[model samples]
Target chain A: MKHTHAEENYLKAIYMLSEKQESLVSTTAMADFLHTSAASITDMIQKLHNKGLVIYRKYQGVTLTDRGKESAIKILRKYLLWEVFLVDKLKFGWSEIHEIAEQLEHIDCDTLIDRLDHFLGNPYCSPHGIVIPNADGKIIDKPRWLLTDLSEGASGIVSAIKDDSVAFLQYLGKRNIYLGAKITVIEKIQFDGSTDITIDNQYKINISRKITDNILITL
Target chain B: MKHTHAEENYLKAIYMLSEKQESLVSTTAMADFLHTSAASITDMIQKLHNKGLVIYRKYQGVTLTDRGKESAIKILRKYLLWEVFLVDKLKFGWSEIHEIAEQLEHIDCDTLIDRLDHFLGNPYCSPHGIVIPNADGKIIDKPRWLLTDLSEGASGIVSAIKDDSVAFLQYLGKRNIYLGAKITVIEKIQFDGSTDITIDNQYKINISRKITDNILITL
Candidate 1:
């Protein structure tokens, strides 16, 4: 079905929220993410439900239907692929790709995406470490471990990051810790939820628990 | 001033046509490029002129104003940048990115392009070998020579291609001649308007004069 950019956005937001929380997404959350009012979210949610792109129960929240999930995944694939293009091809900062990807995700052309996939050499993941689903919505599974989940003395290469914010990515840039960086967990602070890590034998740096959780490692 | 995607498309078509031939863009030509009717082109030209984005003189034809030039360049920048992103980052086939870039150029965000510029490492040209203008519409100058103009036995690296059509790009792909291929001109036959060329010391090939004109080279 032909959907407007706004409608597609709502479905994508619901899909992402549901993925993160593993539950129905609240109207307030949708409203916040979309930067629209709760009333607007309600209206759009109802519209989406009617279109069979979402399953919504009043006041209980919303989730995407199978069709909706497919659509959302398609949009996400475009988004992440464009992000990879921006970062890998255009040399855009990792932090800056999200907003551009948001705009690109609405481009409705299957052939374009497939060709883009070929142009980018069929990347398995985006710059931010998110998997880009193939044309059939299949994602390549990679071995990953969260930084916070690693024990003291554990070591691995920095494979990807969960958070894609420009600020966080820029911080990683400043620290010289990026994708493919070899890292060792030097110490774990139980009290403050922080960790000391060494990168490439250069420096030992302290990172907050929040930052640690955002980093992904591959053994 | 904000312009709709449809409006931008119209202006871009006019701009490209005017650049190629005369300053006066015909409604029929506009319609042909935009896949619309002459009547629709006339309607859009009137609107664009009314908004001071174009200069229209009835049947005499239409031209873009300084403002229209700025707007067109902006769209061009977005389009080319996205093309670079698609081919360079996402691994999309060059033929595939044009249609998608056509849609993405309308996304209204200045920072997105700038950030994309940084992410793509400030590419001076797109995958199709089109020069990418800077934010202020200043084009980056590169030393380039057309394959048709090169003397027989002249050797240079393929820098860009003049043609962007899917069929043409795919043909180049089939011949293993693309942007950045090291090519040496072997023989130029003036009568048949064809050339014999050697690529990377591997194979000597005969190329039609028409194809030769489309290939751009750099020393």
Candidate 2:
């Protein structure tokens, strides 16, 4: 029932990739995502297949079996819960908690996780606005769109983010952009696709299309 | 420098053994303490010696170098701090925190550990009454004696314990024996070494010499 740290990481990778791709995840894609070699990905995929965690095809790719999906969700649940704890309780910057949560997620103690959930008052989402899956792997996810997708004059609250990289998170932190912050698009530059937006109607600034694309919003 | 989990475990084993023996730790003793083979202990000792973490001499056993001792104390600090957090914040029983702390100690982030120390209000000791080393590996250890050494009519407060095994802890828990509890020895049996004692002037119980020897008390 327990997986190695490497195995858990692979499962999480496949799960994330599957969420976006909606198909079997290629070994090449897995290699790129994990920054590993294709040969190593193939080798690990075969190992996971043998463990009944994944279904691997020679040319097509690999997909998580039911068991593997459960494992991945458990890891994610721990990860997001720890992220909430780090930011909400420990006062760690939101940008600083990802790596720590990455290490904490692999700790295999259901009771500790449950106790932490209670200790944190059972937060519904992480600081990044990502919904935290429950112990039963049930998640309450809502539809959200990238900030760049909104038209001029459109206003909405920040919901989630597509990128969780430190650089991106730190950039948002410096700009006072955070989950649940309200923003209204003032104008869109035709040439660069950048948008001028007012954050809580306090100040206006132009952010690149790339940054806008990563910021999810709920109108 | 970062050490692998296995290397850290070896360092901790050597440090603990050195504390008790006040000399080099034999490969046989290390093997027994780690529940591993002597061959493996020798192999790891040789590896640690190469890494300047330990000094290994043939037949005389192994001892931690200054670098190795620092690593061991760091792990101990994390372990004890987490035990305090689990008991004080998360409401875990004293007996249940040891195994969880054992796993948490290997988390290798200095910032996280320091923040945790601050969050716990810089506690000086763990729930088991063991002095927790600071970030600089400095510890404030008070002198204490095993309960079995006390004579009849002797009175003291429980300060620490020599054994942290779950069984021993659970036994103490069931008998209402805890750190800071006052005890007065009523009778000492000469034949078996078992003694009768009152806990906090609440109840009297007869405990075996093995239990008495493990419980450290401060007069």
Candidate 3:
């Protein structure tokens, strides 16, 4: 079923929020994620529920039906593909592509997106190392560990990022950290959850617990 | 100023309609072009006028202000650039790219567009051979003539297409006619205004006057 831009956005927001929390996605959380009002979220949730895209319970929140999940996956597929195109082809910084890809993701054309995926050589991950859902809405949930999970001697390759905020990405840039960088935990601070890591076995830098929590790595 | 998708679409429609006629664009013509009601067109035109994007004179119609024209040209630039990307890179047919480009043109990012322009190697025209305006919104309107104006035995290279309708473009595709094809007028029938032409000194086909009038050629 064809969906409006607003509807698609709500689906994506609900999908993302669901990933972080196992419980039903709260309307307030959705409102915060979308930077909208609680009342607006409730109204849209009703619209989505009527469309059979979501199941909403009074005072509880909502959950996507199977159809809604599929629709949201399609949006993610488009978003990741365009992000790949922007970073891989157009030479945009990984941090710079999310907002642009947000707009591109709403472009309603499945064939165009399939063609773009092929043009970009069918990337499996976005520039931020996030896994891209396949054309059939299948995504492989690869094993990943947050940087904070490692001990002082543990080491791994940066595989994905949990946070894709521009400020976070810019900070990563300033720290010379990037996807695929081989990192070794040099020191684990006992006072705080901060960690000192050597990047690619080269430059050593200290990162806070917040940074470590967001940076996913594969041993 | 940032423009909504509907507002930008109206600006583009006005710009395109203005190109066909020298006078102000009528609400009826805009409604026809946009497939909306005359009342809706008037409502939108009034909104545009309030933004100083257009000068609306009741009954006579509307013309874009300088700022409005610039905004329209920027939309055109994005549209044409995406068309080039779709056809040249994504391998989409010339006819198929317009609708996709229509969605892509509304992507709002000056830096992304500039990067895309650079990535596409600074194309001069779109897949359908329409001149693309530069970043400054300056377009070089090259001289072109309708194929119907070409006399018998006159020949030139096809430079642009006035009608980008899917049916017309598909017909051109079926007949192996394309942008940059060298077409020679073999015969022009005065009775019905249909013309016989040879394409690339190889394939010969007869096309209707409607086709001839829509194909633009340069001597």
Worst 10 residues of 3 chain A by lDDT: A87-96
Cα error of candidate 1 at position B69, Å: 1.1
Full ranking by lDDT? 3, 2, 1
lDDT of each: 0.84, 0.87, 0.88
Model 1's CAPRI class is: acceptable
After superposition, candidate 2 runs with Cα above 4 Å error: A142-219, B142-219
The number of residue pairs in model 1 that clash at the backbone is 23
DockQ per candidate, 2 decimals: 0.45, 0.46, 0.65
Compare candidates 1 and 2 on TM-score and give the better one: 1
Docking tier of model 2: it is acceptable
Stretches of model 1 off by over 4 angstroms after superposition: A20-28, A57-61, A84-95, A111-135, A138-144, A148-157, A162-176, A180-214, B58-60, B84-95, B109-135, B139-157, B162-214
Candidate 1's residue-wise lDDT over A133-212, tens digit each?
A: 99998777877889999999999877677877778877887888866678999999989999999999788899999999
Candidate 3 regions with alpha-carbon error over 4 angstroms: A142-219, B142-219
The residue-by-residue lDDT of candidate 2 on B61-171, one tens digit each, is 998888989999999888888987887678677667777887888888889999999987776677777788988899877677789989899988786777867677678
Q: TM per model?
A: 0.72, 0.70, 0.71
Fnat for model 1 comes to: 0.57
On lDDT, the candidate that comes out on top is 3
